[model samples]
Target chain A: MYQLIDPILVAVLLLNFAALGASQLRTVIHAIALQGVLLGVLVVVAHNEFTIWAVLMACAAITLKGIFIPRLLFHAIREVSIRREVEPIIGFIASLLLGGLGTALAVLFSNTLPIAQEHVGSLIVPAALSTTLTGFLILTTRVKAITQVVGYLVLENGIFIFGMLLVEAMPFLVEIGVLLDLFVAIFVMGIIINRISREFSTVSTRNLSSLKE
Target chain B: MLISQIIVHVVLLLVMPPLLLGVIGKTKALFGGRVGPPLFQAFFDLIKLFQKGSVISSTTTWVFRAGPVVGLATAILAGLFIPFGGHASPVSFSGDLILFAYLFALGRFFTASAALDTGSAFEGMGAAREVTFSCLAEPALFFGFLVLAKLSGSLSLTAMLDGPMPNSWGAAGASLVLVAASLFIVLLVENSRIPFDDPNTHLELTMIHEVMVLDHSGPALGMILYGAAMKLFVMCALLLRIVAPFDSGNIWVDWGIFAVGMLALAMVIGVVESIMARFKLTFVPTFLVAACLLSAFGIILLLR
Candidate 1:
């Protein structure tokens, strides 16, 4: 069970690096969506048992994270007509270095926590932490509002990775509720992205600062 | 048996680097749909260059002539410390890894000085860029060394590399992977390959290492080319030992594996050069920093 999931988790960690390093908005979105799909698979694999609830959660995760949210982001970018995340507050290389540091910290931090016996040596917690840190990195370093939305989705994906550890303890209803909340939040953010682009003629949050005065 | 192995190692080191360059050219040619230069083109060029007389600038001192000589000498010296495959190095001791690293630095110091000796603005600029990039690349190489030191619990390169049995890969595979990846980047940067600097470019403004040698001619340039190839060979040998840590007990099999691994690595570098454009000079530091982070992460993984 672990042998199957660990590689995917590592792949998730690498995708985080890719998303962090990528200069194109489109690449970041695709990397995040692939990460979401991988997390959906993680949901099934972590359960080990083929429960109906596990299958349902996997389906919901795949639909929302892999298909629906990415489409929304693509649509938003097309509507905004911005292809690159240029003029980032932090350069791609520096962000990549920070991402590496975050991965190291994640590994170290995961060591301090008590873990389930089955998942003790596994990379689940560290991968989750690293993904979350990378998401936070993207959110803080990039000026694009749409990229920030992608960052939030990545953070949510990290949360989903961590949430997989509690599959037995948590109820399925709560899981679906969390997914629904993400969908609605992104839906509203998509609308806001459109409004911001329309009102300001640019999606850069730096320009939005002018309205404060 | 030891003497034969040493002879084989030295011979292979001398003969293989130019071929590796050829293989890279061939691979790039294949990628570009051109027949490119012949496989022995580097050797032919070396022969042609060595037969010609050097052109010395009056502004330059002996340092200009000494640069390629010292560089080639240091590369050959460094080669003595690096073990090929499962065979031990010709020279190895406690703390030799430090010397191994500094030997390359010593070569660079002279190479840069020689470039500066020419008193040309372009050469000086190339020398500055070379030193700056090496500053960033050095830490990545050391961090990778740190990971190896921690993994094998030794400071000696030979002991550190040979100590990792096949079973060790299973235990610390992730760390090894990170180290290998980081070392590969270092290899590329140190060799001034694509993504950091283009070796094929003749444009004075865009060149990094090549620009530094723009004034050298004849046998001096030949020495530089040989030195560059030897340096590439040495770095590639270091990477091969890590990535292909297998030992078949028979010395011949081990050498065979090492040879194949080095060629494969050259081919990989060629493919990388083919597909990716060199990073802008501003981004080169970022790329090197990423290499450092990778090896740093490897050390972190080992420590935990």
Candidate 2:
């Protein structure tokens, strides 16, 4: 179970960094979808004993996160004329550097804690947390609204990895509830992205500053 | 043992958040010139809202109703891990802080989603600002906790604070000021208070959390407002936990200090509210960024 969880978690973290480094909106979206699928696989493999209900929930979560949300966002991108993510607040190299720093920080911090070494492997929590922070950094640094949403998804993936630790402890009802909320959140954010594109004539969040006093 | 702990945890979990709100409200009022309404004002408000039926906007969907309940449930569940007075939390284990933080994000996500669901431009604007500031604020918060864990050499909040790690008043003071300041910004922003926002304001342009719930009424509205207040109190309690040097043995004295600290913090917020005007919207992020910088400073101080 630990082995199954570790590789995917690391891969997702790397993919999140890759998304941050990408200049194309389409590439970022694809990377996020890839992460969603990886997380879906993780949910299935990480648990000690997987029930049919767990499998179904994992599949549903994957379907929504991995497939449906990306498709909807792609459609929203098509509606908007802006296709490229030019002039990210941080350059690609800087972002990669920051992602590296974030990862190192996670590892360094996690090592000092009393968590048993054998439980989830050494890298899982720190890597996930670092990836989460990196995603957050990208979200704030990027000017494009779509990139921000991608950043949010990356952050969500990071949280999901951490959530794996307490699979036995947390009620499945709460898990499903959280998943449902994320689905609706992304669905609604996709709608808002479309509206923002139509209203502002660009997907850049910079334009939204017009309302400021 | 397990069953009793679970029961106790569940009961305390359910009861503490609302009472925290009551304490803050009463404290803020006392700080102002007048004697406030009863501390149970929130409970009274909840009851009144239950009796009154809602007036739903024709434009609104089921999303509006679902949003508040989702936010409240997420909050209550998240509260399970936060150690109030010094007992191991109900769901204590490694990486619990991550869940605690993310659960709050779950609340914000729903709140933002419901705001957008209304299709009102005002609500959308408020949601946008909320996300923007929180983006800066959340990392600062997590980093502060990371430093606290380092200082105490414990993973969970209950352990990190109550464990026998040597507490440096300087490091603790810096970190506490940093975290408390960041959380104070969060308290004002999350609760839609003055400076970040004016809770009393009806104009959509000036709204943060308020406009999001413009369409919700009755029990739903009550839950959202009460939940918002509870969130403020939760953050305050966390702040108090950082500042007040209460060991695991002296739980009663710790609870007393916690209560007193809660009032002091609320009074400080009220005073700040009375003195400050709402910052210009663009400038609000700058204020939050300042808090984030202070948190970073706190972390660096701990490292040194």
Candidate 3:
């Protein structure tokens, strides 16, 4: 079971590195979408239960995170017609180094935490923490609003990985509500991205400094 | 049995490095969609270089002469301390890891000083870059050594390497993986490969290691090339031991596995060179720093 699940988790981690190093906005979006899909699959593999609740949660996660969010972000990028993330606050290589450091910290930090009995020896928590740190890295370093949205999605994917640990404890309705909230949040952010592009004629958040006054 | 193993070790140390270089060349050529040179190309080049006359600059001192000689000598000496495929090193003692590392450092110190001895601006620049990047690489190497030390509870290179048999992987796989990765990066950087420095480029301003040897000719240049291959072989052997970590307990099978692993590693390095362009000069430090963080992380993972 672990042999199967660990590779997927590793792929997700590599996707984090790819997203962090990618200079193209489209690549970043695609990497985040792949990570989301991997997380959805992880939910199924991690649970090993195959109950109705687990199946539904995985489907919802796949739909909202993998399909819905990426499509929305891609549409936003197309509307803005921005192809690359130029002049990021932190350079791509530096951000990648920071992402690696974050992953190490996450691994070390996870060791100190009190993991549930069933998830012992599993990489769930460290993967989740590292993914979240990578997302935070992308969020702060990238200037494109669309890239920031992708970062936000990656951060949520990390949270969702952690949330899988509570599948047995948390109520089913709560999970659905959380997915619904994510959908709405991205919807609202999409609208804001469109507005920012229209107002500034470029999707770069660097231009948004005018509104600081 | 021990004498035979030592003979095999000496033969491999002498004959294997040039082949690895040829493998990398052929792999790169294949990637570029051209017919590559024969696997014996480096061997032929070494022979050709050894037969040529020297070209010493009037301004150069004895330091220029000593560079390649010391470099080759230190690389060969360093090989004595590294075990191959679960075989004990020819020379091993407590605290040998420190000797193993400093031997490379001693070679670099001489090489850089020789480059400076040329009094050429380009060689000076190359020497400066070599020293600067090595500062970052050395730390990563030490941290990797630290993890190995912790893993085997030994300061000796042979013990540290042979101690981590197949069974230890079950216990500290994650930490080992991190260390192997860091060591691979160090290998790439230390050898002046692509994503760090391109060895094949003709542009003098862009060259690092090649530029340092621009003034060297004949046997001296051949010695430098041979020394580089030896360094690459030693580092690749170190990484291969960690990554493969398989021992069948038959000496012949073990040697065969080690040879195949080293060749495959060369091919991997070739693929990396073909796929990735060198990083911008300013960003090279970032890459080395990342390597350091990786080994440091390995240490952290081991402690946890």
lDDT against the true structure, per candidate, is: 0.89, 0.73, 0.87
Task: Return the TM-score for each candidate structure.
Answer: 0.94, 0.55, 0.90
Among all windows of ten consecutive residues in candidate 2 chain B, which has the lowest summed lDDT? B163-172
Count of backbone clashes, every candidate in sequence: 0, 0, 0
Report chain B TM per candidate: 0.98, 0.87, 0.98
Mark the regions of model 1 whose C-alpha exceeds 4 Å error after superposition.
A114-119
Between candidates 1 and 2, which one is better according to lDDT? 1
Q: Return the lDDT, model 2, position A9.
A: 62
lDDT of 2 by residue, B1-304 (tens): 2566567656655555566556655665766767877877777888898789998777878887789998888877776777664545667777788888888888999998999988987888888888887887787778778777777777787786555432545445545655666666766776677878887687657667777788888988888876776677667666666666565465556556556666777767767776778877765665565555446645744553
C-alpha lDDT (0 to 100) for residue B213 of candidate 1: 90
Q: Under CAPRI classification, how is model 1 graded? A: medium
Ranking by TM-score: 1, 3, 2
DockQ of predictions, in order shown: 0.56, 0.02, 0.37
Q: Which of the predicted structures, 1 or 2, would earn the higher TM-score when compared with the native?
A: 1
> DockQ for the candidate 3 complex?
0.37
Question: How much is the lDDT of residue B66 in candidate 1?
Answer: 95
